[model samples]
Every structure is written in structure tokens, then in C-alpha cells.
Target: MSDERTETVGRSGRLTMRDIARLANVSMPTVSRVLNDSPLVTVETRTRVLEVAQAHGYAVNRNAKKLRQARTGTVAVMLDFASHRHGAIGDPFIFELLAGVSEALSIRNQELLLSPPGLDDTRAFEDFHRARGADGFIILGQGTRDAMLRSLARRGIPMVVWGAVSKDAGYCAVGSDNLLGGRLAGEYFRMRGRRRWLFLGDIRHAELRLRYEGLCQEAAEDKEVTVEYLPIASMAFNATGQTVSAYLAGGAQPDALFAFSDTAAMAAIGAFRERGLIAPDDYSLVGYNNIPPAANFSPALTTIDQKTDVAGALLVEKLMQHIDGGRARSILLPTQMVVRET
Candidate 1:
């Protein structure tokens, strides 16, 4: 009987759970349970079934499973195109954060759907969710869409944001302590006795605003310490570089500088270099998001680490909780300083 069943399975074009069950010498229900990751199946039986399925190169029909469960088992990850702009998607830190989110979702057997740019409006977000496109959403940055996100949350949407957490935010968020990061940068500048500090980033961004506020708070302690902020509308490398270059052209020199992103900081460095200025010699510099290139840069940037991997895991976990009909609060990850040459 075993030989006959094996021969029949071999003749079939595609192997099914029934074939897997017969090969593993288990009941059809047992194979089904194992495939569904149900705890009802014994470990030894589950192992045998999986091995048989793998041996036959079987693939599960995810669409059918989603229909049965009435859940998409996919998460939509939205980027703030309005703030970062199109080219800014190439930013390494965004890739790192996305990688973290993808890794976390894979462990949970969830799919990641990268939402199209310009979905910052509440209507688009609602349309996507209502159409069963994703089980939930994980927004990469708050950008200037905080109000839109809040509206979605009030409508009982399952979503989590990666940004600075506000006390009255309706939606759950997971992010580093921006205020603390900025303060650390401020303290570092003060410790070196560097006055005339400059900040380069768009304060319209919630996260960057918090960073600027923290730096200002620390600089206010000493009247001699002055902090000036230049709001760059776009975070693109060329745009940021041009902005910094123009500022330097105006003879607005600062002894120290802090940028909200590593990319912006590197751009500022290049801009200053054009004006015969160098980091740690002409001015001390600090940047946020300790991306890989930060260490490889000419000056080896001093930066605040946002713990991207942990933040990713937390974002997925919190979104899952929200999907399961549970309340998940915002999480603020501790920020750490990575002091290098800059």
C-alpha cells in the first residue's frame, strides 16, 4: 500500500497535503494542523510532515489560507515621501529600519507590502485598509502627517508609527528618545567649550522639532552658548548640501553643528569643506541615526544610535497586538551616543 501510494504521488503534477500525510504516515488532520502551525500537532509528527512536504517541494496557497482566516497576514509599510522626498528613499537609515521591520514580520509569518508614495492622506490610508490590502500599517516616519495618522487611529485603524512619541498621540508609536539624543549632542558640544552651535534639519518634522527643542533647552543653560537652526525643506543629499553651502556663503559660521540625519550631516560636511572648513578642526559635528556610512565618512561622524533593529521588532509586535484587538501604547526607545572622530 505504501509503495502504491508513493507511486501515485509521483505521477501527480503537484503534491498536496494528502500526499504529504500519506508519505509521513500521519492523518490528513495532522498534516493540516502542522501546515497551519497549530500547537495541536505533536513536535515529532510536525517534523515528519514538514520533511515530507519539503522533500516534495510543496508550497502552501497563501491566498486560500487568508480567505479561510479572513485576514491578509500582510502589513503595509508607508514612507513619508512629503518629508524625505523621492530621492531620500535612498537614505541608508530608512533601508535599515525597513530591513528590521521585514525581518520581524518574516519571523511572524507575515508579508510586507511597501505602500506607494503619496499615501500620506487619511482617505488613501482608509481606502487601502478597507480594501483588505493589509492587516495593519507601519508608518516609517510621522513627517507632517501626524494629524492624518491621528484621524486614522480614531477610526479604529490598526497602525503603528516610527517617530517621536507625543503625549496626546492617538496612534501607537515606536521610536528613539529624540529629546535625549539632542541633549547628548548639546552636552558634547558644551563639554568641548564650543559655542555658536548650528542645527541643520527641517523643524516642521515632529522628530526633528523635538531634537531642536532639546538642543535649545540645553544651550539655554549657558547664555554664552548660542544655537541656530536652519530649516532645510528637503532632506535630499544635494538639497541639504546646497542649503548648507548657501548658509556658509552668507558667512554664518558656527563652531559646532548638529544635523537630524546622518545624510544631512555628511552633506553639511561637504558644504563646509567647499568653504575651506573641516570637522573637528573648523567645527565639531554630530548627527542622528548611526548608519553604517557614518563610520566610513571622512570624519567618522559622531552620532546617536536609534537602535533600528529593536525599533523594528517593537513596531511589528505592537502592530500585531493592535490587530489582535488589544491596546498597545507608544514605546520610546533609549538613545545612545556613538562617539567617533567627529
Candidate 2:
């Protein structure tokens, strides 16, 4: 960008970075490089830029300084879900994930930047890169952005995703063993003398699909056990309630229930109550991602812990490796069941 425009843009009798650039007869970026102490600026140019700034009593904006350094000391967390469709954007899982990521970043004096949920991957990543908003990114899911992510990776963008690990993904990923989590829920139900099982969550997601496969594999071992899959048509509580109500209305009955998330589990429970059924009495229940309020539910949720703490730490560590120009490997942390009243 040209610095000559400073004379026209600057406020009367006040000095801006643009004015300093104009005085030093250099590009605005050169002045920024000098202020940020980047080695890219020649010693003579740096001296001229500093002299102009000192003569004009101009102060640098902290954010501008960081941008010039090319390392914002910030990591952007992008949610790759259709929040409007799910209506679960504010779900406990999102908040818990943010908390874990924030805590981990804070430990290293890095900041967290939350991108708007459901943003178009290509556009979002391009804008973030052009603005230099963050040093790297941690994508929450692989949704429909796999192709875009792969494309970006081919161009050397630093990123880490949280979801199923796949050889074709071509991007660093960190997530819990979703297959093992599903198996644990199934094994626990079978041990409790339950036969019929209903699996919840949208299987279109790569992670949920893997979990569904594992659950079915475990159910196959027991001839008497039957497993049915149900995709959550919507993420609204009432939507889940409506689905449960319809299932009950059709004379369908499952002895065990496994909702992919605690929010869905709670919604299912509410639907059961409307039909005069209680959990662990009429049917056993299991949820995934043991968020904080899971223990306070009426029946206290029996859910699987996705280990958000470890996921968060691994995401940050992996992104750092990529930022330092090193290859980052995917990780699959083990999941464990946290048994409660249900």
C-alpha cells in the first residue's frame, strides 16, 4: 500500500503510522516491519522509519505490531457445523471444548479466536490468512470441508482438526477413540441385561459414523441383542422430543438408549418422561461427552468421556509443531465410560 495517501487520510496536526511511512518514503508495511523489529527491514530503512516515528511522536497499535511479526500468538478455533440447522450451537459440548482449548492456550500465553460457527471453510480460511488473524487454526469437525482442508494443506496452511482420523483427510487431527466409546456404551448396556438398543446422532458425520459401526459390531456378538440407528433430524430439543414421541407412538420400544451427546440424551429423557417412562427402570440410558451438567441430570447420565482436556492439549501442541514448520501427526485418545445413576 502506498504511504503517500497518508497526507490525504491523516487527521489535522496528528501523526499516524501512514504519516511515518510517508515521512520515511517507504511502504506502510516497511514502517510496520521496522516498528515490529522484523529482520526483513534493512538497517538503513529501519533507522529512517524509527527517526520519522520519533520525530512525529507516533505510537504503534499492539495488534498492528503483532501482525507485522507474522505470528499473532493466537490460534483460531473454527466450528465446522451447521449451527442454524442443529440449533445446538450453544450446547454444553461447545462451551466445554472452548474452555479446554482456552485453558491450554493460556498456559502458553497464546490467545484464542473463535470463528463464527458454520462459516464456509474456503472463505473463512482465506480471510483469516489475508488478515493474519492467527498463527494457526484448530477446526472442530471435518464436516463438508474435507476437500477444502486438503486443498489448504497442499498449499501449506497450518491446521489441526478434531474428529475421526482418516488417511485420506491429509490434515492433522486429534480426537478420542470414537469407536471404542461406542463399544463401551454397547458393552455396558449388554452387561446390564439390555437387548434392544437405539443409537442417536447424525451418522453423516465421520466420527459418529465410526461410533455407529463400532456399536453395531459389539451388538453382533449377542444374538438376542438388536441395534437400530436413528439420525437426529434436527438439534433442537423439541425436534429430538418429537422423534422420540413418534417412535413411541408407533409402538416401538428399545431397552437401551445411546445418544451421541449429553444434550441429546437429556432431550430423549424429557421425551420419555412425557410418555411416562423412566430411565434405568423402563430403559437404560447412555450419553457421550460427559459435560459438567451430566452428573446433575435427574438420573445422572451414564456417558462416555471424550477427554476434552487431552484433546485440547493435543490440538495446541500439534498446531505449534506445524507452525514451527514440522510435520504434525494425528492422535486418537482413548475414551472411558463414566457410570452414574443411569
Candidate 3:
């Protein structure tokens, strides 16, 4: 470590591995090894090289490194924008899931590329993979694209979905036990002596279907209980609100209601209030996906907890397993009821 080497860096006004090597009195290869955190480098040499590089503010070009390694070192996170009336970006649950995945990727020193919506088809997935856009993908929702996802899996595409798990699904998935979540809500309503029940949310999607089925199953246990449902295509606030408002205007009276999502439940609540109806007193309501706003809602929502905190780690782990030529199995997390004002 001589002053001459420091002067050389000042003269060039740019830092490089070669400069770091010279300053550390080591070969360029040694500097590269140390910078890459290769275990082959001795502790003393690694420390000296790192100190020199840190002192000069030298940083490795990750893009060049990834290119040389022939791997993008990035994961593309895709969401089904069309499924939601306001797009997936408008959903708070989507943001929560993204934050989890982003944190998990950061821990592994990998980049997260948020893919735009409408990349739901297999060919689009293939093209993106072939173009070296990312090493793999993490889909946010299955949304009736199970067939397309199966095709991608058959073609050896590396992907993992965050949604309901299907028995015949070819790809890996990480999701909650939606059926149990619905049953819990149903049981709670029954205990509260709510006989007339109404369910909201489109069952065309596999996850929502399971929840509806579970609620129905629980309701069937009591002959006096009657369950009805309204098919809602979009989870957008305005769309759900309008749909619920119209249903209420039609004189649809139900003592209990269960929504597939907290957002939908909130929208329904707004609709009910517009018609001079309220929860608990008028109807015992339950919602799914205990999102952040659920607890702080005017009458704090009673919803299901889907364990989103560890979902990202599991999704990233499973996707990496697929990328590494390993077969990763789908995981179904346990769901629980979070009782609140609603």
C-alpha cells in the first residue's frame, strides 16, 4: 500500500479491480476472487484487498458479473392485472406479498424485476426467459391460468405461483388453506347465531371457490342455516361497491356475510351502510386476507390470516429449487381467524 498507487487512482479518477490489486500488492485475479467473496482467498489477503477497495470506493459491476456468469441473477415477479378491476397494483395484499418477495431476494443478493401485467400466457413467459430477462419467475396469482402455468412447467420453465394449490398442478405454489379459512368464518357466524348468510367474490378463481365451498360445507351442518352468494368479478373498490349496492337495492337481506377478500368486505360494508345497514347488529361479517387496513378499519374487520410474512421466503426458495434442477413441492399454509370488530 504505497502513496504512488493512491496517486495513480487520483490521476485516473476511476477505480478498477486492477487499481485495487496494485494497491493491495496482489494479482488482479486475487482481487477479483476477494471481491466475489470466493472462499479460496485467504483471510489476510481478502481483508487487505477489501480495505483498499473500500477506501477508494471501488464497486463491482453486477451486470457484467451476471453476464459473465451466463445467468441474469434476477427473478421476474408477475401479477394478473386484469383479474382485479383496478389492476393488481391497486391491491394492498399484492404490495404486501411483493415486499416479502423483495426482502427475500435481497437476502440472497438477487434482483427482483416486477413484470408488467398481461404476461399470463405461456409463450410470453417463454419469450421472457429466452431473452435472458430473468433466471426464473414468481407469479402472484393463478387466476384461471393453471393450464398456461402447466404448459410452462412442461417446457421446463422455472416458476412458482402464490395462490391456491391444485392437486394436479405441474408447477410449485405457496398459498393458504382457503377452505379452512372459509370454514372458520362460517363457524364464527354460526356461533353468533347468524342464520341467513351471503357470500361475495367470484368463485371462478380456484382460491375463492375453495373458500366458498368451505363456508357452504359448514353451513350445511345446520339445517336451519341458509347460504347464498353473489358472484363478483372484480375486487376493485368501486366495482365491488357498485355490485354490492345493486344487490342490496334488490332487497337481498342476509343476516351474515363472508367476503373472499378484506377489500371486498370493506366495499360491501360501504354499500350496506349506504342502505342503512351495519355489521354485527344487522349482519355478522367476515373477510379474508387480514391486510393492514383490516385492523384499523372504522369497525376493525374480522378476517383470516394467511401467513404472508413467510410466504415470500417459501416462494423464492421453491423457485430457486426449480432453477437448480430440483423438484419443488407446493406448500399450503395454515389459515387462522383474526377476530375483530366486524
Candidate 4:
């Protein structure tokens, strides 16, 4: 390829503050200040420098730029890859939080790099800060005592944990009032004359802990009601079927159920059907995070609307403001209940 054309194809391969300054007829420091959006440069000087640099097709290498100035103009987002890719991502609660982040980032011309989740290497945070200068991070899903996060915290990695992170100052969090969610579930069941209730899904997920807490709090007010918590970890369709059989055979059938999530609600509903029972007919039921499929279900579902789209947008907004000279802050969006057939 021709040198000129090749350089155009690889702007990241060639451009630097030095080159920009050289073309703009300014000192390297002057160009550097403008690149960092420093107000020290007068408007005339800043405009002239920028025009010259742009005319010459100068571009900033994020890595090199960050190394020089300690910022990549980037924010990292960690998501539950397993859930997001599986079409199970949106539940009202999770959706709203993510929307808030995404909207905030978009206005500031920033992006969310949804880091894949896994049980693999946990030292990724250390490597991230070592090479690239990331100003901060936004953790989206359920990751606990992560090595990367801990190392980053030990080194003072600025971050906002949506529902992750300990309540330590090292981590800032924006999470739903899970206790409220649980209470709402319990209230819904109690009002419907359900005294014996069942709960489904793993209690290990961080969010579930909050949901369960909320339900217990509300159910405690009612003396006659009892809430049973069940774990289905590592259990598949057939195994879950057998587990459900035991519940029926043992005569511990619940008058109502409040699942930790919509998926779990569906799973429970399926289990109920397997035993020739109908939800909200033979027994009342309520679910959380009225996801799209919740409405499409055979009897639909009664649940909470956590507003994920708004949350995702808000997350983006927060990232953008922080990138553009804003200080860190925590935000909480409200939740509402959505009543349907079930």
C-alpha cells in the first residue's frame, strides 16, 4: 500500500500529540492541553490548534493518550453474559438500572464495554489498570469478591457497582430496594388469602438475597402465613420435575408462590402444571421483573416493573458525566408493580 494511503487506513497507527503539535505549529504541551480539554488554552488558540490537527487528520490513540494523561475516556461494564445472551436479561429491575447507565453514557459520548462474566481468570482488573488507564468502571451483574475488583480496590480503582460490591467505601453501589420487592410479593399473596407460600430459584444470587429479605420482612407481619424457600441450583427440567413431585407428595403444597425472578416463576409454573394445578386458580402467584415473556405466558404473570431500559440508559449517563469532569454519585430509580392474569 502507498505510505500516505496506508497511513490513512491506520490513523491509530500513526497519529500522536507530537504530530498534531508539529502540524498545528504549536508546542507539544499546547496540543496536549487542548487534547485533554483543558480550559487553560484560549478559545482562539484552542480552535486554531484543533482545526490544524483535524485538517491533518490527526487522531489520538486511546492507550497512548491514556498513558500520557492517565485516562482512556472509557468505562468498563461487566454484565451477566450467560443471561444477556440467553434472552433472559431483562427483568424490570435489572433493565431499569442498565437503562439509567446507558442513557447517561450516551449523552456524554461514552460507551459501555460489557465485559463477559465467567469463573475463569480473576486477575483481569490488575492487567486492565496496568496497561490501559481506565478512569472508572460500572459492574452490572452478580460477581462476588472478584480478584480483579479486590485488587483494583486495594489500588484505589474508582468504580460504581450496580448490585455488586461490598458496602465498603472501596465500592460504590446503585441497587434496587430488594427488601421492598420481597415485601410487595408477600403482600400480594397475603391479600389474596394465601397463607402458605413457596419461593423458587437460587438464594445465592446477590439480588435474590435482597428479594428474599424483603419477602420475609413483609410476611413477618402476618402471623398465620409461612414462606418456604426452595433451591433449584444445578437442577434441570427433569430434576426439577422430581423436586416438584416431592413437594406435592409431601403435602406441603403452597397456597401461593413468589418467585425470585420471572424465569424462576415460569419454572415454578411449569412445575405446578406438571402436578395438574393451575396458577392463580388453585393457588395465587406473583413474580418479579415482568419481563416480556411474562405477558406471553399462558396465564400471564403478576410482577414488578423494574424498568430496565431506563436503568440501562441511566448507567450510560453516569459513565459519561464522570468521564467529562463530573464527580461520582449514587442514583436510585423507583419500581412499580404490574398486575396481570397470574
Among all candidates shown, the one with the greatest TM-score: 3
lDDT to native, each model:
0.89, 0.82, 0.89, 0.66
Residue-level error in angstroms, candidate 3, position 198:
1.6
lDDT of 4 by residue, 52-101 (tens): 66766777666665566656666777665443324345444455555567
RMSD to truth, every model: 3.3, 6.5, 2.9, 5.8
Predicted candidate 3 versus true structure: per-residue lDDT over 201-303, tens digit per residue: 8888889999999999999999999999898778777898899999989999998999988988999999999988988788989998899999999789999
TM-score for each model: 0.87, 0.79, 0.89, 0.71
Error of 1 at 70 (Å): 3.2
The residue ranges of model 1 lying beyond 4 angstroms of the native Cα positions read 1-31, 42-59, 116-118
Model 1, span 251-282: residue lDDT tens: 89899999989989999999999989998998
| Candidates sorted on lDDT, descending | 1, 3, 2, 4
* Residue 84, model 3: Cα distance from true site in angstroms: 2.2
Query: How does candidate 3 fare on TM-score?
Result: 0.89
